[model samples]
Target: MADAPQEIEALIDMMARLPGLGPRSARRAVLHLIARRGQLLAPLAQAMQAVAETARECLNCGNIATADICPICASEARANGELCVVEDVADLWAMERAGVFRGRYHVLGGTLSALDSIGPEELRIPRLLDRIEAENITEVILALNATVDGQTTAHYIADALEGRVRVSSLAQGVPVGGELDYLDDGTITAALRARKTL
Candidate 1:
């Protein structure tokens, strides 16, 4: 890094800041990109520029989009009267990657946290409530993470919409590949509570 040009060092530092990348990995990546500048670096730069210029949050759902409304929000087929609430755009993307959920989504940006001073007003809760009425949503499926803040946010949303619409949450429990011995107490408890007759 000491021998490298200032601009190259700066690029490495920037890449190192990305999630899952360390300084060593970033240095290697920068070297690789420099070696293949014509084939990879130029194209990557163009693509990044394009995305930076066009990407925006969907007006209705808060999903990342290149337009005012994301494709899911604009599609008539996705209006299934079910809204899946999530803690972030990453969560929404994860749900989409699974291809199991078919309805539209509402990204909350983040969970409520008293320590962080984050409340319902800080997220998209008010927008979510508005969408429930505007879209004639029949059910809201909370897909938040199992963290304490996530659960707290879910409870708050549930209580807020108690009588207005049917509200539910994704089941919490031990994962399919998890063993009882390896599972935590809370996971075991949730699994037992959610056990079925089958």
Candidate 2:
């Protein structure tokens, strides 16, 4: 690093600031990119530049998109009256990856956190309520994480839409193919509570 040019060192430092990356990992990544400048570095730089210029949140669902509305919201087939509410775009993407859900999604941006001063207004709770009527939503499936904050947010949403529409939550439990020995007590309890008859 001492012998590296200032520009290279700066790039490494910037990369280090990325989530899950440290100075050592960023340095190694920078070295790898430099070694594959034409094959990877240039293309990656171009892609990042393009996304930086065009990336914008979907006006309706808060999904990342270049246009005003994301493709999911734009698709008529996705307006199935079943809206899946997630905490972030990452969770929305994860649901999409599963390919089981066909309805649209609502990104809350974050959960309700009293300590952090994040409330319904801070998230997209109001927008979600508006979307329910506007999109003719019949059910809202809370797909928030299993964290305490997530459950708090879910309960808040459920209470808010109690009479307006049907509100449900994603079942929490053991993962598929998970061993009982590896599961925690809370997970085991949740799995038992959510058990369905075959």
Candidate 3:
């Protein structure tokens, strides 16, 4: 509006909606992108467009993938009879970045919450139960956050999967109310190593 081009303004607005980015940072980022249009902006635009069209939830796991089944779900090497359940895709990516767990992943999309009206039906809980038997999963590791909602969700899943598979959770190393994405690789590794049965 203030003498800025409509396209640039729109880009800034969209960037501002990204997590952890504010209007001020979005404006600066847009300006930097425009300055490096040929090298950065154009390619980034293309990549975003491509992902927007192709990105979808994996059928087996709830992880985002370009295909129906994510690479991790499709890989035989990852079918280690252990499944780590995370509350979000970012948490799954964080676990992958740590490179400590060799098993598959099950993304719950979100935690159950009565205040927000979210429930098991909304968070892929039923699908997870079906997957346990279908995939012959031996162990389920709850890598949910330390928040109240996160712990509640973990307990729900542990109860649901009891007797079907050995269920465990990330140990005390994870800070209270902390999300996995905020934890360092070493902490993730240590927590995973010290995981206790739920």
Candidate 4:
């Protein structure tokens, strides 16, 4: 097969760098887009440009927003005195997609990493504390990821707000469809510890 032009090859290279897309997939996608340039490629380019210009982080939380504050932060109904702490905007989006939690969110952007030299100051920890008091937060639900750095950050936050407000963490355990045999030792232990009596 003949090689794509330099510009098309560059687009393919950039698309391949996107998550879940390899070179073959990106090349196929580029071909598909080029085949329907007016329908898909032009609109996709416009959308990307729009997002690049308007997308920004919320001033209060780290969640993505086109405005200064996210809709969740602006909505009074979400001010239920409960704050859900998360590691990243993606995690906050995941919780919203589940529709299980009805509260405000605080995105930490990242967790503590001694190796990477990340600390509480690097994240939105200070802002989190400010919101806890300013928003009259009654409880802080630690919804951080199940990673070593995540847990360390959770512990640090828990200690910081120990006497000020109620602190709790999401229960870690096996997934609904997970099998005991498929679970790792750490997951199995966490599942057993988090088990509730019927």
Per-residue lDDT, model 1, residue 14, is 95
Task: Give the runs in model 4 whose Cα sits over 4 Å from its true position.
Answer: none
The segments of candidate 1 whose C-alpha lies over 4 angstroms from its true place after superposition are: none
In model 1, residue pairs whose N, Cα or C atoms come closer than 3 Å (at least 3 residues apart or on different chains), thus clashing, are: none
lDDT of 1 by residue, 1-198 (tens): 489999999999999999999999999999999999999999999999999999999999999999999999999899999999999999999999999999999999999999999989999999999998999999999999998999999999999999999999998888878889988898899889988898
Q: Enumerate residue pairs that collide in model 2.
A: none
* TM-score for all models, in order of appearance: 0.96, 0.96, 0.85, 0.94
Deviation from native of the Cα of residue 43 in model 1, angstroms? 0.8
Each candidate: RMSD: 1.1, 1.1, 5.8, 1.6
Model 4 global lDDT (CA atoms, 0 to 1): 0.95
Relative to the true structure, candidate 4 reaches a TM of 0.94
lDDT of 2 by residue, 133-156 (tens): 899999999999999999999999
Worst 10 residues of 3 by lDDT: 169-178
lDDT of 4 by residue, 47-107 (tens): 9999999999999998999999999999999999999999998999899999999999999
Summing lDDT over every window of 10 consecutive residues in candidate 1, give the lowest-scoring window: 170-179
Sort the predicted structures by TM-score, highest score first: 2, 1, 4, 3
Each model's C-alpha lDDT?
0.95, 0.95, 0.92, 0.95
- Error at 104, model 2, angstroms: 0.7
